[model samples]
Target chain A: MLTVEKVSKEIDGKKIVNHVSFQIKQGECVGIIGPNGAGKSTIVSLISGLEKPTGGEISLSNRPISSWGVKKLAQQMAVLTQDGLNPYPISVFDAVLMGRYPHLSFFQREGKKDYDKVEEVLETVGLTDLKDQMLDTLSGGERQRVAIAKAMVQEPSLLILDEPTTFLDIGYQLNILSIVKDWQRKDDLTILMVLHDLNLAAQFCDRLILMDEGEIVKIGSSEEILQEDLLSKVYHTKPEIVRHPKWDIPQILLHYE
Target chain B: MSKKLFQRDRMLWLWIPIFLIILLIVMSVSVSLGAASVDWKTVWKIVFSKIPYVGDWVTADWSDSAETIIWDIRFPRVVLGAIVGAALALAGAIYQGVLRNPLADPYILGVSSGASFGAALVIVFGWQLFGVGRFTLPAVAFIFGFTTLMIVYLLARVQNKVRLETIILAGVVVQAFIGACLSLILALSNEQLQTIIFWMMGSLSLTDWSYTAVVFPIVIVGAILSLFFIKDINMLGLGEEVAHHSGVSVQRTRFLLLILASVITGAAVSVSGAIGFVGLVVPHIIRLLFGSNYRMILPLSIIGGAIFLVGADAVARTILAPRELPLGIITAFLGAPFFGYLLRRAKREYF
Candidate 1:
């Protein structure tokens, strides 16, 4: 569904993403994992077309990124970013309804169809009780769920998650991923998630793309990419890779020097 | 249970329309109280006569001077007040949403202080460019106000990209510089100083149909442009990425809306001096009752602002009788306290 060919992005004399290329197949769950400043978010931003690549090309379904005006591109993909939601006080329903904005024309308000979709989404996300409550009143976990529900309501082919579980507790981290995992299965949703926790990435993603210094270090199934030597070398940290006893997925364990 | 409450909420929506009608009634009452002391019935007769089908039903018994007084003199000022009020409030609401800051006002772009300088120059020097005479001050005021906005906008831009915080900060800096210059100008000029000082305080006292005629089209056109982007503006509070992901052209919407909002504020300040408090308070006040939805906030604030300012102008005219209080004083005094009360009561509901 998406392709990046030697895509590079530079800003103010610094190469944030350099000579990186990857293809994401339809219905595949992919994770981009890297240490801080490994250009994880920037790469996500580039793929989302929120930021333009300084060189090379990114194409969605065979069309170049530049050709997709923001409105058209938005209908094709939804993004959940780590950046704080604006602190403007708004109700949960109103926040979720905003996801339907791209679908509505200029000056056209959300109609019965839009509200019906929002009601179903709120129920799916377990926020029906809090629908009328202000978003500012929501807990971190609830806010993240609301954000996810917002993305879900977009009904896009591609869903991008940037640090989807950052600032969340372990319990919430598991919960958010489970929701994503379920939706990916249900909708055949193509997810490109940026995860900081290597273990979570290994557990949830079908494949992992390990990155370092604005370049891709490895791209393969989690079992292949989460190898101890490659992760330790790329992350500059000693690490141990273990398999889940039942699930048999690769999980990374960091060690103190 | 919540669905029941939602239905009740639908019932409560009638309150805004009813309140708007009350505002119209108050405006009618206000025209009667100012200077001439005409009765409400007489005022309505003149008002009704101007309407197409209603003219024959209107008694047409009112005097010619009374007709001129109500229709020509007082009616225009009230309508201008409503226009200025609506313009300022909508500008405030848009600024607050785009900047994602509740405290942001239309004057955050330095329009007020810039207009002050222009009005000050006219009052102090007694110079009327192009022999425009009295219109010179407002024309210069609009030009200077617009220029300040452009300067702030430019300073906030880096490589042709503008950040919301940068522009707001730039406006603060420009306001301070222009404010100092204005004070210096006021201090140096001794005669006709009250004219400048009082105008700085802002008044609708100078309003006439010509002022209203010139400003109405500009404000209405600006308002129409703003309305076209209502959906985009509603998404702005989600922040740039989320708004963009929702299909809003963030930077473009912000740029166009900023210009549109500036048009409302600059044109308003040009005609009405620099009324404050109404823009900042009216939107917040409306949001308390209506929730933070821009759909509700936009129209409610426009009407609510018109009501508030015209109400304030009414009190400004009749509170002391014969001599008028500056419109800003009444707005700040009345609006700020009312807003404080609403804020205290609805702290959790503020959107």
Candidate 2:
């Protein structure tokens, strides 16, 4: 449902996203993995229409992303960044209810249906007990969960997660991704997430797009993309790859030389 | 779960009536406790007697001087104070919300400085706006204030996005430049120096019925327009990106809000001069007492601001009795230390 055709974003004189092209069908979760400065976030920004590409076009369901109204596009997609939300001292429920902005007209306060959506999403994110809790007082994990709950309430068919697990602990990381997993399954959601952890990327994503130096290195299933040779070439670090004991997906292991 | 939600909504409902009562009481007290010391019963009787049909019923047992003091003088001054207070507070809330900075205010945005500069020009040159007479000063002030906001907003925009830090910096620099020009005007002046100085210090004492008539509709209309965007302002507290992700047109919303806030502030400053802290401090107090929700903060700030300024004006005129202090001085004395305390205790985010 999403396509990027030779999209290139130039900042100053340097190319942040250099002629990158990829597509994700409906109901698929694709992971983009790379080292720092690989322009994964820029690609997400372009697709989300937060920033325009200088060179090429990005389209959602065959319509140019720029052609869609911001609110119209928002009703179809939601983007979450690594830093999550600012610590505004808003109640968790109110923060989540903000997701209904696109659905309601101007001067229309959130009615019963919108409130119900927020309540349901808060329950799903296990934050029902903390509905009255202020966002700034929450832990990093909890705040990200609030962000996720907010995104869920947006009810977007396409979800963009831009390195969402960067500051999270391993446990919270798994919890967040699992929540997204369940959400995708239930809603038939399509996800484009940038992941720093290659092992988690292989485990959660059906397809991986490995990138290097603002260019797409390869795109394939986890088995094909997570090969040690390809990863070492892109990341400039030698690592061992082993299959998971249960799921049999390729997992990366690193050791001090 | 639904019951809890219902309870929260109901709780919010109770505050409106509560604040309205407080506002009414405070206004009444402010109107009564001026230099002449009118009694509460006399105050109400005089106030009620001014109402159209009610005036027919209320016996005019009170002296004409007392009626003049209540109706012609204190009543309009107090009402003007409420209008200016509400405008400043509403503008402050919008600035803080849109800029995503707690320190943001109309003063921070150069709106007040620009208005003051325009007023100073009128005072120095004695411009009557080509026979427009009494309103010429405020009209020129409004034009300058609105223009200054546009300039500051444009200066801060980079790559189609307005960074909070950049906008604050832009406003401060613009304010400094305007302040310098105003100082130059002050230095070159002869007879109008005291008028300019006292006007800069801000006072509600000079206000009459005409001033209220000029400012009332502008603030009321700006406030009504602001209601449409309070939710958008709330979304902005999550930052522009998240607000955009949730479908708020951040740039357009920011522009409209800035214009609306500046227009309201321009009107208030035109009539009241640069009353500091009413805008900056009132919204913070509301957020501290209530919550960071703009839906509540915007409306509550209106009442809270009116009460704060009216009360401050009362204290200004009556604190030294015969020798009245400037309203701005009163506000700073009360608002600065309280704001400092808020800052010191602000370990929890109030934004």
Candidate 3:
């Protein structure tokens, strides 16, 4: 479980994340949805300890996040930011192996245990065949899967992905979301992800947090938070919520200007 | 059935020949062929005499003058060239990794200009302010070089993160300012002007066994230290956020790398007087061959860089015969065209 209490972040006297508070329970897949510049990424950064909050505390598993060393924090939580794309031509295996960095010591090589774990993660992410392939050769979808594999290799309690499917195609997006959902169910992993697609978030996420201009407007189950009126109010656009015939999930339809 | 094993086996085989051929060609031709036209036999004699037990068989027919020329003069210069080359390349690789910019060189921190100014000050005043025994000029150069780099690094660092553009701009500005200072010293100095001028132009002529003795340990230590940080450097190449998430102290690692690289650049410049392009070119060539893996690239750069500068030095010595060209000039001449070709190739490939 992760709890963020009254977290606020300011840069040069301008508030980026303002008085944001949220709690994520164990095994819950929470989605943060907002338009561009809505401070969704900022919240992820704060949660991942990339940026410190000006006012408030974040705790994981009832312990203060600040008490955790970087490696300890990494062991508990793995974050894959939108800019996780590496320009270097590294092999996929090596790229995923980087996730084990926090677990390994400076002088230690990747031992049998490390390689075994990596092999397991490669299989989990469906990238076992592409392990030896160069990252540059992989497609955008394959790259995101590789990123997810990297995070999974950490075996963290919480997985935080900021805009993981922003550049991916619909099939790839579904593939990633399904994979996350499957992992959440099987491993009981806590996931907090940012998504631009309201429909995808509504379908895949157990809970949804709606944010607008650095503040969370609402947080609840997708059915409660994905109301047409609330989304219209938050996004300043008309959105229709329809029931999914099979899954009983809310489906969102946005009306363009 | 064993296709996967075959692929892995082939990959290993591919690198072995490529690495060995380049290593061999660069080492043999660079060391054996030189300006003095000394036969391979004499060169062997001179080299073997330095070995404790094997001296007699090789040096039986060698004269004292020949031995002195080979052992004291040419040998030290070659060794210094190799050390400086390795240092420069190592520094270049680190800077590129830290900045995530392929074009970044060791001079990005303004160490070269700082060392040059230090040398200028020593040459003009003929005084060693640092009080370093024996090798005062180089010691002074190193001190100023390291100082200038620290200053530049500090100026470039804003809110802890060192912005690539800021570092590059600071380096250029500080370099210009130091160049003016050097000019001022040149204008004021009356005595030892010729020596000052020659040194400023950059030379390997001043190299001796004593200079080599002083720099060898520092370069070796710096190179070895860099090798240990290859993994950290690899992480850094991915950018600060990724590195941090991977549990690397990004800022501290970057700072240490910069200082170590500066020490290398300073030490090399102190002895070789700002020999350019070896740092810029050698690492690029190594990367082209070895891929971007720092684990392989760093060690290969050390050996490859040594071979490169030794070859360049040999060419510099032999090409002009009796009239020796400055080693800096030779490197620049070779480096500029190679740099242009690389730039064109990179543009075509990446842009």
Q: Tell me the lDDT of model 2 at B99.
A: 82
Could you estimate the TM-score for every candidate?
0.93, 0.96, 0.92
Poorest 10 consecutive residues of model 3 chain B by lDDT? B1-10
Chain A accuracy as TM-score for every candidate = 0.97, 0.99, 0.95
* Whole-structure CA lDDT of model 1: 0.85
Most TM-score-accurate candidate? 2
Per-residue CA lDDT of candidate 3, range B207-274, in tens?
78888888889999998888778778877766678777777877788888889989988888888888
lDDT of 1 by residue, B1-351 (tens): 111122113433676687689779878987887666789889988988999998988777878999999999899999999999999999999998888777899999998899889989988888788977678888999989988989998899987689988999999999999999998998898887898888988898866788998899998888777767767877887778888877888888888888888878999998888899989999988777666667677777888889988899999998888778999999999997888887777645455
The reply for model 1, stretches above 4 Å from the true place, is A254-257, B1-15, B125-134, B347-351
Q: Which ten contiguous residues of candidate 1 chain B have the minimum total lDDT?
A: B1-10
lDDT of 1 by residue, A1-257 (tens): 99999989899889999999999999999999988999999988898878889999999999997899898888899998875465456778878888887788886867899889999988887899998777777788888888888888888999999997898999988988898888888899999999999888888888899999999998999889988889878877778777888888888676776
Per-candidate interface DockQ score = 0.61, 0.69, 0.51
Write the residue-wise lDDT of candidate 2 on B182-264 in tens digits.
Answer: 99999999999999888888888777899898889999999998988978998988888898888988888888888888889
